[model samples]
Target: MPARDSIDRHIAYWRAEVPGLDPDVEGVVTRMQMLVRHLQRRRTEALGELGLLSWEYDILWQLRAAGPPYQVTPTALAIALDTHPATLTHRLDRLTRAGLVERARDRADRRSVVVVLTDQGHRAWESAIGSQADAEGLLLAPLSESERRTLVRLLRKVVLASEKDGTELMVVPRSVQRPEH
Candidate 1:
């Protein structure tokens, strides 16, 4: 038999409180939520060690991921990050002050502006991302390669179903394609 976890205890309490509760559904949802919370905490700690807040790392990461001469229009970045333009501007201001990014007039269109990633920004992004990857790897270390693959497949199915039932999933920007791993 598998070892019992906190989710198991949680489901037990809920089952007594509401007898109609489906243990299978409750268990799966609770476990996924708990896992996400755990991962978020780990990511927060990792980013903190690098002197980065989550949003700051996100902006730096998006800029670094834009291939060399790494830069992008503020509008495009706002769309990619799913943030409002005003909110993005505020973030940009903070990044700019930290010397992590700079706003430049686009040579192609004098009226347009672009956000360029500075060397310092790239280094910070790289270190933060490395820490994030290490944390994720440690989290999955208990699973075998095949198990990891299976888990991903199953999660993809769940995500697709959820998307189909409601709004479409946000499209990833073309410039932010996943690197070949």
Candidate 2:
């Protein structure tokens, strides 16, 4: 038998409390939720160490990931961050004041503006991302490389199924999609 974990105990308790509770379903759901919470906590701690709030790291990361000469329109950025334009404007104002980013008028379209990531912003993003990657690596360290690959494949399959169904949101955030080289 596989080694039992906290989810196993949780399933047992729920099965007793609710006679029809399905251990298989409950185990999978609870374990996934717990794993996400654990990762979020680790990421939050890592961001804190880099003196960044989660939203700040997210905006910086989105800009950094936008390929060289990292810049994007405020509207595009707002969409990428799944935030309102006004909210993005507020955040960008703060970022600009901190010298992490700058607002520049588009050369092609003088009326439009773009948000450019400064050297400081890139450095902050790099530090926070490195720390978060280390935390994720440590979390998955117990799995063999092949096991990790298998897990990725399985999770991708499940996620795709969810996306295909109407039950889950189908949009993949632009920041998360791999950029073409």
Highest-scoring model, lDDT: 1
TM-scores of the models, in the order given? 0.89, 0.89
Writing each residue's lDDT as its tens digit, candidate 1 over 23-107 gives 9999989988998899899999999998899999888878887888899999999988889999999999999999999999988
**CA RMSD for every model?**
2.3, 2.4
Candidate 2, residue 118: CA error in Å?
0.5
- lDDT of candidate 2 over 1-181, digit per residue (tens): 9999999998888788999998888888898899989999999998888778899887887787777678888888888789999998899999899888999998879999988999999999989888988988998999999999999998888888887756555554564467569
For each candidate in the order shown, give its overall lDDT on alpha carbons.
Answer: 0.91, 0.86
Query: Model 1 Cα displacement at 122 (Å)?
Result: 0.9
